[model samples]
Target: MLAIVSVTSPIFLLIALGFAAVRAGWIPREGALAMGRYALSFALPALLFNTLSQRPLDQIIVPAFLFAYVGGSLIAYALGLTAAAVARRTHPLDNAFFGMGVSMSNSGYLGYALISQILGAEALIAVAMSILTEVLLILPLTLILAELHDRRGRHGLARTLGKVVFQVVRNPIMLAIAAGLLFAALGWRLPALLGRTVDMLAGSAAAVALFAIGGTLAGQRLQHGLGPALAIAAGKLLIHPAAVLLMLFLVPAFDPTLTQAALILSGLPMVTIFPLLAQRYGLGELCASALLITTLLSFFTLNLGLWILGS
Candidate 1:
């Protein structure tokens, strides 16, 4: 346990420092947002590209791991949607957003940092795979459902699908993943100077991203829709990981490290963009509250998950 704390403490300490910095007015919320933007738009993508590009193509693609991760996410999403329907009886759009909040883990920021520290460079494959599942499958499905619910059958399916595809392709993270895969497939190596530069940027991603998450949390209020918010957080931190564990048991075999990484990723809080995504449909406050709650709770949940996996 002490060993586990030794591994995990620095991650949360950076987060705590950011939270304190923001709460103390040392850095405004906007400053945090700017840092987050830089992390997302540049640092993370560089890190991902470097991680993926250096690996052999076969090592980077793990089919069983992808299936287990995606299957678990889908099951959790369905459970969340069902719960929302029975409990809240809210608009379908709201339910879709709620379901998304439950299933979408903060893999890029929190999961990547923690898993990379524990599992080393190989963990990046799991991070990349989880991001692919989120970006390509879970995110698009939820957004399309929400859009359809909002539009009320006024829009055509083909157009909606097209728009979603376009948006996913244009995402910076997605582009980086694609480029990295292509580079790996071609057996190309980065020139020494360029590689060093990317390495430097990649090294900054973990701490900056974690600190930015804390800063973001400092701006969120814990009030409003407490009942549903708590439920959503519980689903993300508990049910999601449980589902991943089940999937790992049932699915065809995968690398044990990847299985562990997937479990850790599943146990993370809702993605940092939860509030921003919710804002598109005026569900920001509910999502923000849930994000804050899940993030706080995930400290304990994630530690428990690690112990379970280690055991």
Candidate 2:
């Protein structure tokens, strides 16, 4: 238990520091968001490019991990959506966003930061696989549900999903992945100065991303939506990780390191953009409160998860 705390303490402390800065007005909300954008668009992309470009194709592609993680996430999605459907007579559209909030992990910012601390460079590989599952499967599923519900049979789900795929392909991280794969395939290397620059940027990616997550979560009010918010947070912090762990066991023969990575990633709170995504459906307040609660509670839940995994 002490060892687990030793690994997770610095990570959460930095997050708390970022939260304190924003709430205390040391940094404005917009500035914090800008920090997130810089990390995602610049620092994280650089990191992905470096890791992907240098590693052989076999190391980066883990089919078993994808199957296990995606399957578990969908289980979470189904459960969250079902819970939403049974409560307060919400439209299926709103429920889709609820499902999304349950299923999507904060793979971009928090995932790498948490994993890298525990597993060192192995985080690069683990997080890469986890992000792919979110982008390729979980996100697309949520958008599809929303579109199908909104259009009420006017729009084809397949067509809507295709458009979502195109947009996802153009995401900054996905673009980085593509570029890195191209470089790896061609055996290309950048000039020395450019290489050094990328290395420096990559090094900053984890810390800045973690801080940005904390900043984005600041100032979310915790009233008026406590019931459903608490339910969603509980689902995210407990059911999601348990599902992933179960799926990993059923799948069999995965590397233990990647298996641990899958469990930790699943145990994370929902992506920070969860509220923004729900804002489109008018559920932002609920989602934001849920995000706050889940993140605050994760400090303890994650400790429990680490202990159970090790035990």
> For this target, which candidate reaches the highest lDDT against the unseen true structure?
1
Off by over 4 Å in 2: 151-159
Please identify model 1 stretches exceeding 4 Å from their true place: 151-154
Worst 10 residues of 1 by lDDT: 147-156
On TM-score, the candidate that comes out on top is 1
Which pairs clash inside model 2?
Answer: none
Q: Go through the candidates in order and give the clash count of each.
A: 0, 0
lDDT of 1 by residue, 93-134 (tens): 888987898899999999888998888777779999999999
- Candidate 2: tens digits of C-alpha lDDT, residues 1-311: 99999999988988988898999999998888999999988998898889788887777777888888988999999889998898756889878877887889997788888888786776577788777888878888887787777734545867887888898988998898888888877889889999999999999997888888888888678754688888888899888998887888778577788888999999999998888877775677888999999999999999999898889
Candidate 2 positional error at 37, Å? 0.9
What would you estimate as the lDDT of candidate 2? 0.85
Give the distance in Å from residue 52's predicted Cα in candidate 2 to where it truly belongs.
1.6
**What are the lDDT figures for the candidates, one per model?**
0.89, 0.85
